[model samples]
Target: MENNNNLNNSEKKGIGRRDLIKGLAAVPVLGALAFSTSKKNAYDQNLKNSILRELNIDASTPPPTGPMAGDPVRLGIIGYGIRGKQLVKAAGFMARSEKEKLQKSALENPNDTRLKDFMEQENLNVRFTGVCDLFDVRAEEALDTVTTDDNKPKRFGTYQEMLASPDIDGVIIATPDHWHAPISIDAARAGKHVYVEKCMTHKVNETYELYDAVKTSGIVFQVGHQHRQTQSFVTARDVLRKNVLGHVSLVQACTNRNSDNGAWQYNIHEKASPETIDWQQFLGNAPQIPFNKEHFFRWRKWWEYGSGLAGDLLTHDYDRINCLFRMGIPKSATASGGIYTHKDGRDVPDVYHVVMEYPDFQMGTSQEKGKEKGFTFMYSATLGNQFGGRNTLLMGHDATLELLGNTITVHADPRSTRYKEMIKDKMIDPEVPLYSYNPMANGVDGVTSATAKYFANKGLLFTYRNGKRVDSTHLHIREWLSGIRNGTKVSCGIEEGFEEAISAHMTTLAFKLGRKIEWDADAKKIINVTEEEINQCDFITI
Candidate 1:
């Protein structure tokens, strides 16, 4: 999902050779496209059809006229963990509000007996039929939270038992990363829609497996990369796409943390005893080790269960960047870092920097005429606190964009004379917000008298561009529901999840191989490997 603004700029320039050249020059050397017998045009057409079919309604239908109609989509949550609780809460709120509005409207119009009867017969609120977890306490807690008389959700011990129930319409998976693929595949096979968390799966091959299952099962599947749904990111993509900063050349995105907790050093609660924790269930496919409370709760520290900082933090950045650029997976990846700070027995790296290559799809040797260049993307993340904050930098051909948490700044590339002049003259309208001093303030104040007074008294100031602030949390959930309701194409769907996982795997490969790694995207494997060779050599496994 490239920014609409950026698309407009590409259109304005006609995606010229100059743009292609700029992109190719910056990308890493190991990254190169290998065109073969496969018809690229045909493949793209198939992808378009797949996207259209996934979203049940066609482009002509225009998103369910008036208000969202039909019986409230019955939903079944299969996990009672933090994320599971969040889904129930958010979905429940939306469902309740929508139902209230319909009922109120029906009551106000007394003549409309059909409308009144419809409200009574078709309950608009979601019917949470089932909740499941291995532990009875967790299952009961989840059931207690969803105690709505309009729709009382049943509780169960195992996911299989819950899936057997005819009442379930969909499943919200919030289990550990390792369980993500298995549970999602099972749910899809059982003919249920799935809203799986980010990094979609634990291993590289599992992504393909899950993708096939979802496609074959004809089910709605959404990966939980919530920021994709956020208004802020949407607005930023739009602003950048419009060439507000003039031809972006380079992008730098990072997530920083100083505290141990911020880096997944979760505190163990006193209640986290063997009685409350299901040791065998938590272990799942992971090696059968003795029950350790820390491993059960803060499993992110262990490579056996989690993809470390790369999957947790970097994946979010990758998903957001991909949406902004309208690009897919990189050709090659390289990374360097270590557990330099906390020596808490974590297997994965505590800090890391990775460079991903997006080869120039159009570039050709001087031998070929009418050829264009491609683009490159570079990203990094670390635990060490630096520059005193977090940010995402988008570098382009004419200008460079720096996007801090709630602010964005654009600077001209020193090499471009025209870009420099544009910057000097401020040819770009000042209507686009610029971050100056007093960075703590929220950037979206609508210029009211109270806001003016607050800024004047505190010497605090910021500007709001014609940008939409994204609520990543809300968007993530809404996108999941939309995928369920309309069978819409998910922004961070299976392909994206696979692409990100592969990128992370390649980073580990490059670090271990101690050389730049190349990939054969067509074969879906590293180019030099033999049939029997273990792909594990490319990953950092515990």
Candidate 2:
């Protein structure tokens, strides 16, 4: 009976890639499209256990309940900058069910914008215990905003002090890129769970160090690639697993936003100065320099402080694809482009392009059966142009999967043998999308302000579940907190974070050196590169 039920479920799922292969076994055209039956079973097993949990769907692992219920996880925030404040606010966000009430209230009282800011604090499973920042004003500002039990967050002079405090169960590290590895390593060593913002680390060596620390510490660690929680991505993964797009040969991703803030010209706080900031602490591993307000506010502009395009923007784009296709570090990477637009004394590129080679990886590649010619993952970013909106495309022989913010479109290729029957029957079109998943059904939001739209336009800012809007950050934070209690791994934990880190570092290193960089999977080092070659890159001053 159980076997019958399993068979019924599989049949109900309908005409997946494996089914197409078996159906078209006599046809020569379908030979290249056939994949191993084991692959489908593996995907099904993983989807049932892991991907479903990531999508906030019913999973075998129960959410923290009983003794764990209402026991708020004590969270310490290490950086009170833009991302820090966002994380703090997300911690206090109301669940989707309550958010529906707030939306209804907004419709009745149109003038009351405060309904949007309403957070059902009692329901929140995490509370801010301490806030730390090298900038005194920013730290205090963050503390003033976070309130639990009519309680204000205590300010810590440094992250080290906050890490030493027994009050903090976990630490959210939102500091500059260079500080990520150092703080995360220390936090892990101190046996504190971590939620580190992305780019993961400054350099390749520190990436390994941070991974090692997190692995040995036995604590929950979540990288800030919150897109892993986005429902469309989970849907896209299922679509990919079905082999609807056939063997994906190439992937193209872009980051295009022609705005001052988008280029990292963030408004410098008036209180920013040597008197109000720990300049030395902020410049820990970087070369010592006098306090510069521009560098303090717009740290993404420099190689000394940030990973520029590769780490700042490409990581977001790359991680989204990585989440869907589980493509680990590439075999080789080569990069181009330079600081063509925003020339505000920035050392890193304003526009960049990177091509990463995945030679051995076959999951998302064109490799058929035993053949082993890998696919290429290409990334392009420009701060000067928003001509083509930010998006990603996975090109396959049968179809192309296009992801544009909250929308996913599967366009069938004219040459596809798998879609031949559908095409001959006029079921599939060459121009129009064969399938589309739009989670947002309410067209343009009536209540959302202009500022909300701007931020939402950025990667994975918002997603939907069961046709109701959900905060990706809120879900991501809750996942981390739940994982801490239930001993379940997070969506973008150490393993996922490691892949993102290495991939970003590979692009950054290749671009900076003006050469091609190859990942030696066996030795875990860049092939044909020396310490001198690495040191020559501006970002690798250490």
Candidate 3:
């Protein structure tokens, strides 16, 4: 999961001091030899030990989620598109033929460990007995690959039909952003637990409606923020809570994708047509239009379907930070960008920038209280060039925490209030990281493509659990199932979803309206804009 970027940093801090001081690794032969003869490495070892003891930082991961036992949880898949297949695979249910293909791939290329990892995944004891998709090809493929002698899944024509079935215990919804709220809302009303993908809702009303639906129905609802299961995030939360970073005044998260797939120019299936695809159902609340394969596959390019970088991409980075600090929607947001790249008749901007202000927010420690009262979140993205790919930077008074992939490195600030004495004594160098966490180190990790690498770097594709690489999506799905069967609370529940949706909507609205948008936290609504104005920026009318 980690690249050489950590070592190539200008400071050249050790990967992780604890890993070095404890001599926990053997691969670094010279370092191992040094550790073996402490007489030669006493100064290095003592220095690391002194820093570790002085910092007293906790890099340990939280306990693993409860075991998946008891009767298998009956499940249904609502979307069989790009993300749907990944979600299905993460749910510990892969097609036999697909498994064989991965197996053959591993044999051909020793580095291809996808099959090994998939096979080693601890079975969650789940059954995909119901499958629903508007596309005929995708639906049949799901059946063809997933159906076995013991489990014969039914194919439902519509999500409504699938929700009505008594056979399905819960639903995994990976449909388009617009459909997320509608399907999840109905599924909640149907008394089934729901796991829906990001951006939670397409429009303003649905966000509030879906929240009420999940709340009133008392269903275990989980938003698809799989990074909640990432241990580095847990460590980041710990770091912030422990005030290791001091007063964080600015947060920067970026999305730099330079490929067609990364820009959401997905391949249009040859089988897709009026007869093979459910065009009307796909359109749903969007304007009725003639069948277009481009619209169907590259929906992320349209404001009518996807929220572009704001809802589709920004939300991922937003939620990642939001979960760490538990910071809700910002007080105001300003944004400006255009389709500077990939000008392929798409309305959503390929280059986007949104800045959100949290005036009263204070996740800081040991500074002038009023000085660290406010913070700003800036999300900058460009689909043209991915210069120095996704790295989330949290700047603070005492230290700067860099989150790349599933790893974290905290560099001490020279003018730190918390670590001033250490800096003065030359015990902690501001140039090197004070602490580091890398669960993905020396592991059988793979990043196959630009988009996959992007997700992997964002801790979306995979994360380590108890030192073992586990599909974060799988753990997320299992947590949702546990909420249903074991009465456990889900991590990214309706409340979190509400904040994420509203924040993303506000960012998008700021771009669409070309003005700063303010939120009335007490009123729990945007103060300056009406729902109609907020939702009227749709690109497609026909």
Best by TM-score: 3
- Best of the two (1, 3) by lDDT: 3
Ranking by lDDT: 3, 2, 1
Once fitted onto the true fold, the runs of candidate 3 whose alpha carbons sit more than 4 angstroms away are 1-41, 538-542
Runs of candidate 1 exceeding 4 Å displacement: 1-67, 93-124, 239-249, 361-375, 386-390, 405-408, 417-471, 512-515, 528-542
Model 3 CA lDDT for position 359 = 86
Task: Report the lDDT tens digits of candidate 2 across residue range 84-137.
Answer: 877776777333333566688778877534345334322456678898988887
Whole-model Cα lDDT of every candidate shown, in order: 0.60, 0.76, 0.86
TM-score of each: 0.70, 0.81, 0.91
**lDDT per residue as tens, model 3, 1-542:** 14433444556555555536456555578776777788657877787898877666778785666768898888899998888888999887676667888888888888777777787888888889999999999999888766867999999999999999999989999888878988999999999889999989888778889999988998889999998888888888888888888889999999998999999989998999899999999988887789999999999898778878988889999999998988899999999899888878999999999999998997667787577678999999999997774489999988999998799999999999988998898888999889999997768776677788888888888888767788889888888888887888788999899999999988888888889999989999888986568657643232
lDDT of 2: 0.76
Residue 372's C-alpha lDDT in candidate 1?
Answer: 24
Better lDDT candidate (1, 2): 2
TM-score ranking of the models: 3, 2, 1
On residues 32-123, what C-alpha lDDT tens digit does candidate 1 reach at each position? Answer: 33243246766756654543342122111112112234566667777666566656655543234434655675577554232232232212
